[model samples]
Every structure is written in structure tokens, then in C-alpha cells.
Target: PSEYFKGMLSRVGYAIFFIPFFITYVGHGFFSPGWLLCPGFYLLFLIGLSLPTALLNKKLVGTSLVFTGLLSGVIVFYQVNKLSWLSWHKPQRQILQIIEDVGTSQTKTLQIFDCMAAEKNATSIYRVVGYSSSIQEIFWLNHKVLPEIQILPCSEAGRSVASLTPNIIKLRWSFPEFTVLTH
Candidate 1:
């Protein structure tokens, strides 16, 4: 009973110490969901270590773990490489490129606004596109608020939205079902 109690205490202590270190190492600087999934690797390592290699064939255990690790690495590499193949399917990248081209052609600073509810994603998207825009849902040019290009859903533009504000100069571009408006 004392031996079991001691084992339990040691396990609790190890858990308290190891979990934080493992989390920090896997997460590095940010708590990525992909990083969180990395603990599965540790599970494999534990299983490999706990398999009684002395009772079972040591050669088999070592070879299987080595092969599993290599296969895991190859799978990760393939998945990462597959993202490039999927890049063209992302419409946000297309919109970003269009904004850049239009801004350069017209010699206007690329400033954009999207749905107010998506403000956080919009800001991150702008950051990724290498442009900055102020937040204002009302598509109006205010010298004090800074001139901005408004990015609206196609549905919003089709409703003859110009009637909402009389003096607004809204230049809109429609691509397939998606559209953006610049004012």
C-alpha cells in the first residue's frame, strides 16, 4: 500500500512538472491547434518505451518505432507540401491580389472594409495583404477618419446600396459571386 501511494505521488509530481514543459515546447510561442496535436507523438514514444523489448524481440520493437517515426515525418511533409497545391483555391488570396492590382493601377492607397462582425478576420487579412485600413462601416470619405476602400459582400452591392448615402463614390468590382466596393 505504501509502495502504491509513493508511486501515485511520484506520478502526480511528474504530471505537474512535465505537462507544462511539454505544452511550452510544443506550443513554442503560440497555442496552435496543430501544436496541441503533437502530444500524440509522446504517446507513441511512451508506448514504444513501455513495450518490454527484453521479453519481446528487441530488434522488432526498435525497427517498428524507427519506421513509424519516419512515416510520420513523411506524412507531415506531404501535408505541408499539399497546401501549396491548394493555395489557388483560396479566394481571399485572389481578392488580395486584385486589391493590390487595382490600387497600383489607380495610384490609391489600398484601404478596405468588410462586414463589421468579421472585423478581426478582416484586420488579419489586411495584415497578410500588406495594407492597412481604418474601420468604419459607413462607406464615406472622411479626411479626419482617413480614406478607405470598402469591401462588401456581393449581396450588399446588388441591392443598389448607393441610395443609402447620396454623396458616396462607390467603385465596385464583382468576381463570380464575390464582390468588393471601394469608396
Candidate 2:
């Protein structure tokens, strides 16, 4: 009877650990974001740590973890670009073109009207290399008080998105905040 409780706990622990990749994968499938679904990413970190020996390496657990983590990191980085860790898809290329034109030092602010809103205020879409909050902050400091949000494609840094997504990013600013929104 005592062993049953221990077994249940072990299963729970394993589930909690694998939650991240599952969440990220699940999150990709949904539209409206919720708190319940957000924590899956943290589970991925645990999953990265807990992979079985035969899958990665049996002899050296440390080496397996390090190697798997590096690989997973690379894969995540690639997924953000497009969705796949490997291929250079068209959307990825298109986004890369936009990023290159904008350059690392410069930001190309393009006004964007929200697709999913009763009334989405116009927001500027800053085309840069990748996603960064610092870049958005600078835009806000220099510019007018419009509802501002960063637009980062998985393809921003040449990582191609696997699917043709509708709205990749969740909106950061509410429509009422600014008549003009930076997308």
C-alpha cells in the first residue's frame, strides 16, 4: 500500500517534468492563451534533464544531459524561426529578408491592424533579427503612446515555421490603450 503512493508520486513527478515540450507543442495548436497552458514550457526543461539512457547515452548521464540540452536548445531556436529545426522554408526566407533589411541596429516600424479584434488599434511591427523586449522598450521611449507589441516570426533569424500559422504572437497591448498600436 505504501509503495502504491510512492508509485503515484513518481508518475506525477514524471508528468510534471515532461510538461514543457508538451505545453509548447500544445500551445502551438491553440488560439487564446491561458495560465493553465503557459507552464508547459518549464516542464520542457525538466524533460530535457530526465531523458532515458538508451535514448541519449547509457554510460554517461551527465554527457547525455548536456548533449540533449544543446540539441533541444538548437531545435527550439530553429522552431522560432520557422517551426522546424532544420528546413529553410519560404516564410522563413521572407521573414529573414525583412529582418535583414531592418538590420540589427535599426528597426523598421510598420503599422499593423490586428486581425482578431472588435477593433484592433493600428500597431507598428518592428522588423528586427529576433524577439527581444529591450528593442520594444526603445521603440516605446522614442515613439508616441500607441498600443505597442513586438512582432517576431520564428523565421526572424532564419528559423522556419513548420506550419502556416494565423496569429503567431499573442497581443501584448489592449486596443483601448492606444489608437495607434505598434505591432
Q: Which is the leading candidate under TM-score?
A: 1
Question: Tens-digit lDDT track for model 2 on 1-183?
Answer: 354345434555556645554565663432222333334444344444445435444556457556765765565565444422233243334433333333233333432222323322122122111234543544454443222344433233223133323323222222222122221
Clashes of each: 1, 20
List runs of model 2 lying over 4 Å from the truth: 1-11, 14-59, 83-183
Report the poorest 10 consecutive residues by lDDT, candidate 1.
134-143
Question: Which 10 consecutive positions of candidate 2 have the poorest summed lDDT?
Answer: 120-129
TM-score of each: 0.35, 0.26
Which tens-of-lDDT digit does each residue in 74-175 have in candidate 1? 766675454332342454455544533442223333323333234233223332232334223111222223334555443565464655443343434321
- For all the candidates, what are their Cα RMSDs to the real structure? 9.5, 14.4
The per-residue C-alpha lDDT of model 1 at residue 89 equals: 40
lDDT, residue 55, candidate 1: 29
